[model samples]
Target chain A: MRVGVVTFPGSLDDVDARRAVTLTGGEAVSLWHASDSLQGVDAVILPGGFSYGDYLRCGAIARFSPVMAEVIKAAHAGLPVLGICNGFQVLCEAHLLPGALIRSDRRTFYCKDQDLRVESTDTVWSNAFTPGQQINIIIKHGEGNYQADAETVKMLEDENRVVFRYINGNPNGSLHDIAGITNERGNVVGLMPHPEHNVDPVTAPTRDGIGFFESLARYLGALASRTQGGTA
Target chain B: MAKIIVDVMPKPEILDPQGKAITGSLARLGYSGLSVRQGKRFEIEVDGEITPERLEQATQAADSLLANTTIENYVVRVDQ
Candidate 1:
């Protein structure tokens, strides 16, 4: 499967996302922010970074990018999209996902290892992990606080859309200790932690994050099999 | 040219760490009984007359680009 990684002007983690994708049995395609074409890739990832120098809001300007327009469209059409950190902010800004990320309530940047419990395995990104499984990953960001209205939070809870919940301690004062979440359809997943950084044994703390990439391959395999089974 | 000003602030329900930091600093400086919240202001110059339609345009701009309505409240008005 070909997974496209869109690089915005100030995106710093595209390379790492691409590496993680490649390591998990997918071809990584380089996508540009100015381009609207998705290169017919099976999946897309808006990696973490200070896009547009984080001007105006974390992901405000980047949300207006051409690639983002297409990504948003594709995501609504059921194409799996993963947004990490700044990417998550972009997803919220783009309205592909619910809620918004704000400056950490602690009034400080957080850069440390965080344990996240997998709350939902229905998304293409998290199907590899068992329910309630906890995985350690690196989280490094200044604005990782997630917020939304009471009704929306209630809906997310009722719908089982919360994909990841922070364990041990809430690093950034996210409501309900929410570190990540998915859409109703579970096609789009956004999170504050850096799963891309935890995918390799040589460079990362553990391979805990490889499940996110491996899950995509497994999902595609299941899809291809279903199609074949239908024809046969 | 008509200038439009957009003022944006964090929503009351949302926590404002930066604003709290400012308030804490103010307290440290002996500014008693004072609370502070931080926000942003944007000034945009329209090329033509400031009609009602132009005001609507500024409002839409504020909604789409100038501010994130999820955590912020913004007011767009023609600068007098």
Candidate 2:
């Protein structure tokens, strides 16, 4: 399976994201923010970093990049997309996902190995884990606190869109302690955690982060098989 | 001409630890009478030639970039 990792200016995690994809047995393609093409990759990953120097708000300027235009369109067409940390900020800024990320409740940048519960395994990117499974991943950001209105939160919960929640503690005072979420179609997932950094056992807080990349690879492989059979 | 003010605040569901810490400090400092809530505000100016619809679009543009809808709420006003 081929996965594209987009590199926006100031993106710090693109290399890590690509490495994770390669380690998971998928081809990692480099994509530029200025391009509107997906390079025919089966899925896309928006890595983390202070895109556009977090100027005019985090992920705000990055959302208007040419690549995001294509990403938004492909995501709507059921192409799997995963946004991590600042990528999550970009997703929300682009309105591809609901809610927003603000400064942490403590008004301090947070960085640590975080425990998160797998709330939904139905998403294309989360199918490797069972629902309710707890795993550790790294989270680093100043504006990682997630918030949304009560009605919207209720709606997301009812629709099973809440994909991940903080297990040990509320790191950033996220509403409902949410750590990650999926779109209604379950193809687009966004979270303020650095799963890419945890894919390798040597570098990972634990081996838990590999599940994310492995899950996406498995899903894409299955999709390829289905397509081949249909063509035959 | 039209003017819009947007106020962004963390929703009530999420605890504002910073605010709490500030309030605690205030109490410790004997400024216990102060109540504090943390948020962001924006003042936008639009030209008179811009229609209400156009101004609303501009406001939305600024809001999506300047305000995070997940953690912040925004309100807009027009002045003639």
Candidate 3:
């Protein structure tokens, strides 16, 4: 399986995301923000970092990048895409997912190992974990608070699209303690936590974060075999 | 050239942490009975007379691209 990690100007975690993909037994491809292609990867990861110097707004400018045009099209076509932290902000700005991430209610940048609950495991990103399972991941950001209208929140709740919710306490005042969510199709997922940062046991608190990549591998492998079988 | 100014702000219902922090700081600095809401201002220069149709087009663009309608509201002004 091949996963593409996009690098926008000032992106800090594209390398880490690529490492996570490689560690999960997949080929990691580096994609550029100005490029118009995805390099034919099976999956894509929009990694974290302060893109464009966090100017104007987080992920606001990067949403207009050439690569994002392709990402938007591919994501809508049911491609597996994951956005982490700043990448999550880009996803929201791109309107790939609903809601918006505002400044943290605490009014300061926060960095900590966060506890998250797997609220929905049906998506390609969370399918490897059982629903309701708890995982520890790292979250570091100033504008990490997530907000949406009441109707949209209710719709997300009704559709079971809330993928991850903050456990123990709501760190950034995200409505409904939402840490992550998926689009209606479940192929696109975005979260404010750094799952790639937690993939290595030596550096991170746990290896629990590797499940996201593993889940994608399993999904893509099954999909590939099915396509082959259909042709055969 | 006409300049279209668009101010994008967080919806009233959403929490404005930056605004709140600034408000607190202002209070600490002896300013009272005042509230602050932080937002972004965009100045768009277009080549044409600022007609109603052009203003309307600028307004639409501001609403769709300059602002995230899900969490924000924008006010567009046409300066001739």
| Winner by DockQ | 1
Give stretches of model 1 more than 4 Å off. none
Candidate achieving the largest TM-score:
1
Per-residue C-alpha lDDT of model 3 across residues A1-232, encoded as one tens digit per residue = 9899999999999999999989888999999999999999898999999999988778999999999999999999999999999999999999999989988898778898999999999999999999999999999988879899989999999999999999998888999999999999999999999999999888899888899988998889889899999999
Q: Candidate 2 — which residues are off by over 4 angstroms?
A: B1-32, B36-57, B75-80
lDDT of 2 by residue, A72-166 (tens): 99999999999999999888888888887877877778889999999999999899999899899998988888878789889889998999999
DockQ of 2: 0.54
lDDT of 2 by residue, B21-47 (tens): 788889999997887777666676766
Measured by TM-score, how close is model 3 to the native structure? 0.96
Write down the DockQ of candidate 1.
Answer: 0.91
lDDT of 1 by residue, A1-232 (tens): 9999999999999999999888877899999999999999999999999999999999999999999989988998999999999999999999988899999999789999899999999999999999999899999999999999999999999999999999999989999999999998998999999999998888777789989988888988998899999999
What residue pairs are clashing in model 1? none
Q: TM-scores, in order shown?
A: 0.98, 0.86, 0.96
